[model samples]
Target: MKLFQDKVAIVTGGASGIGAAIVRDLADEGATVIIADFDEDGAIRLADELGRDRAAPFGVDVSDPQAVEATVAFAVAQFGGLHLAVNNAGIGAPATKLADIAIDDWHRVLGVDLHSVFYGLKYEIPAIIASGGGAIVNMASILGAVGWAGSAAYVTAKHALLGMTKTAALDYADQNIRINAVGPGFVTTPALEKTMTDDERSGLAALHALGRLARPEEVAALTSFLLSDRASFMTGTYYPVDGGYLAR
Candidate 1:
């Protein structure tokens, strides 16, 4: 649990769902975490609940490179330096078929899901290197590697992160900056639950070989490990923590 004692971390989208779960997991392992999210209120609330001394809040739009830079700087300023980052803030595409998808929808999803990862690495890489190297986990999805119909934008954006992560890892391998991603299966987060119909929600449980959806904490555990020395030998890999969903 003390794997991260004295370390500093930042988690984008830390206000709720998988992001919030990651924040809590990091804190539990004794890391000083910064909750970076556009949801200012939720960020502040989580920070308070996690102990203000151990957690701080920063409001940011990950798609904005300037905001990402500021958020990284804030983590360094508040915690001495940043050693870990979880770039998890992202948005879903408007549910539509490829032909029906608008240009704006493509841009929007790519902005939050793909470009944000680039923005994060732009600033976070330098900061982590200055701290003598660290780990980073990008939030990808099972859709990142597979095709999901009716989600052209989402599918395209997520698939791109896989390449991004690999290219980044190849360039930074000797620098000790391990960059990876987690491809999660269906997870019953507040947002996901709200958007799915009762039938759709129930049916999704069977999509995984395990016959159930993931818990936020389950994803969080893997994320915490990936960001620590415990996963030192791991890098440039996309882990499918999807309950065997990909096997289908």
Candidate 2:
């Protein structure tokens, strides 16, 4: 049987980039996935491509507690139970220094990148417990461990996520629910492509020991493994898929 056969999963921000890759990986491994994202059309397109029965679309602002709760309920109501989830929704803050970042920008980054995951845990945990327990993976970043200039808000949120992952994992370990966080280095995605020039991208790539930006699929592979039985003993830890970026 496939790794995730008979499992049901929800992946926020699942319509594009790393989230979309994760959605594809889970569905391909036999999980019924809910592609939850702010982009309803993109979610729908992806769900359709995956086949309606294998994947469904959910339009949500993950930062909203109500929307996140509804997503978990929707997964259970539609798929019969919840088995896995990836809190992959996040946003990048502008390139501004700590003191220069607008108040709105700071809150906005935290709302989506940090609060969203908290909301996911609040709703997903109960459902997973009711459904007999499963695994969850939160998408963090290398900034969680290190700092980056002009990214104070993003960095703070990711740092908090690592702590949250550890605490939540410990809280549910005895219940058969595993929780973990993934920290990825610079990944080549549509957003990155649109935002950076080739020279800029090359400069960022040089920061990694691998000397290149990682592909979304590379991150997805680690996420998939974490959500599968293959990682049965893993929990309450942060796994870095950072291409040796932190080796520096």
Candidate 3:
């Protein structure tokens, strides 16, 4: 599992859920990983648990370009250079129709879900380029490929993220940097639990052809692959780890 040995990686939103899972997978596979998240305590705890030598905590508001740049600098300062990045920090929009959604809510959701990714690439691309090239994975959603009612902002951000990933991949293809996006179906993370009742969760699960929700680790595995050399030929693509949610 030393696929990422000697590599340096950063995972935004690395404190919990799919982000945390990606951090653990990358660390376990011998990469020095930085847990970049606004949840400072959780990030620190995870880094400590993974052993301080192999992991470090970086608290950052990804929507802020300055904070994102600092996070990239921190990774380089701590691990020598950056080779991989998972722009996974994002938030859900209020479940409301576009006509009813608040203006502030729209801005907030887009800030975290879409703007943050741009900030990440703005800084990370240069750092990775300085390191002589690397890979990046943006966390998107099945909603990126399909419409989800009552989630205008979230759906819009994911769709736009997929477009960004493709465009960036084309821009960096000859520069040794590979970029891609991952779209996951309903995953039972702490965040999701806070938003849905048990019955609602069950109903959502039934929509997936697998008759169950995806696990955080499952999506983590796909993301790890995208960031590894094994996926060397894979770029500018959107992969769905959705338990067949999009099949229907």
Candidate lDDT values, in order: 0.91, 0.96, 0.95
C-alpha lDDT (0 to 100) for residue 120 of candidate 2: 100
Off by more than 4 A, model 3: none
Score candidate 1 by TM-score against the native: 0.98
lDDT of 2 by residue, 23-107 (tens): 9999999999999999999999999999998999999999999999999999999989998999999999669999999999899
Model 2 CA deviation exceeding 4 Å by range: none
Q: How many times do residue backbones clash in model 1?
A: 0
Q: CA shift at 68, candidate 2, in angstroms? A: 0.4
Per-candidate TM equals 0.98, 0.99, 0.98
Clashing pairs in 3: none
Q: Point out the higher-scoring one by TM-score: 1 or 2.
A: 2
Q: What tens digits encode model 3's per-residue C-alpha lDDT throughout 1-248?
A: 49989999999999999999999999999999999999999999999999998899999999889999999999898778999999999899667989999999999999999999999999999999999999999999999999999999999999999999999999999999999999999999999999999999999999999999999999999999999999999999999999988888
| Candidate 1 ranges with C-alpha deviation above 4 Å | none
